[model samples]
Target: MTGLGEDVPQTAGAIWRRTVPVWAGLTALLVATLSLAYVPMGRFGIVVSLGIAAAKAGLVVVFFMQLRKPDPLLRLTAFASLIFVAFLLTIIFAEVLTRAPPTRPGTVMPRSAPDMPGLGQRAF
Candidate 1:
């Protein structure tokens, strides 16, 4: 009998049969992402791109990473990590959207210093 944690050996054909469909699906998602870049979706583009990216990430995690058959604790850890990243990203985007815009050259009116003498009175 095989010991604990020992994986059963499989033929090359079996491995290929299992993996090829996942590879093809990943390729399709990649192509969709590339094709989306040229479309003018205004504010919705980021959402669409992120959705595709999440799908790609999910496939990789479930298939290549072999997370599907892991212990419950491992799955829980991965889920917690994903939640933490989402929380961080939410905070970051909120801060970015709510912060004041920076003043660029010509955007603000020129003003003389209060302590300066005759600087404001001089003609340009």
Candidate 2:
């Protein structure tokens, strides 16, 4: 029994049995990520790579960090953090998607531009 009077398994064998599958799942995810990199998906590759990384991170957090254990405050904190991150990412994505594309490739202006009223030389 746990300190909270819960009948959670405290045995080493039970913990090992639970953690081993998580480790194997993480390894499989790593292999999938590496293999996907070789495929020529172009723009979609970024989404796939990020998705795999998020999966691996989730496994590490839930299993290794033991977030699934009976602790309401800890679980609420984790959920709130995830929500905050999602909100931030949504704002960033919206800003990026709505921006206008650059018209010129470089900073230097064209040679045809007139000089300033007082200055005779071109600004370029």
> How do the residues 39-120 of candidate 2 rate in per-residue lDDT, one tens digit apiece?
9999999999999999999999988777868778888988999999999999999999986665656645455445434477
Q: Each model's TM-score, in the order given?
A: 0.62, 0.61
List the global CA lDDT of all models. Answer: 0.83, 0.84
Please identify model 1 stretches exceeding 4 Å from their true place. 1-9, 94-100, 104-124
Across residues 69-97, which tens digit of lDDT does each residue of candidate 1 receive? 74677689889999999999999999999
What TM-score does candidate 2 get on C-alpha atoms?
Answer: 0.61
Best by TM-score: 1
Candidate 1, residue 49: the lDDT equals: 98
What TM-score would candidate 1 get against the native?
A: 0.62
lDDT of 1 at 106: 46
Question: Candidate 2: how large is its RMSD?
Answer: 7.2
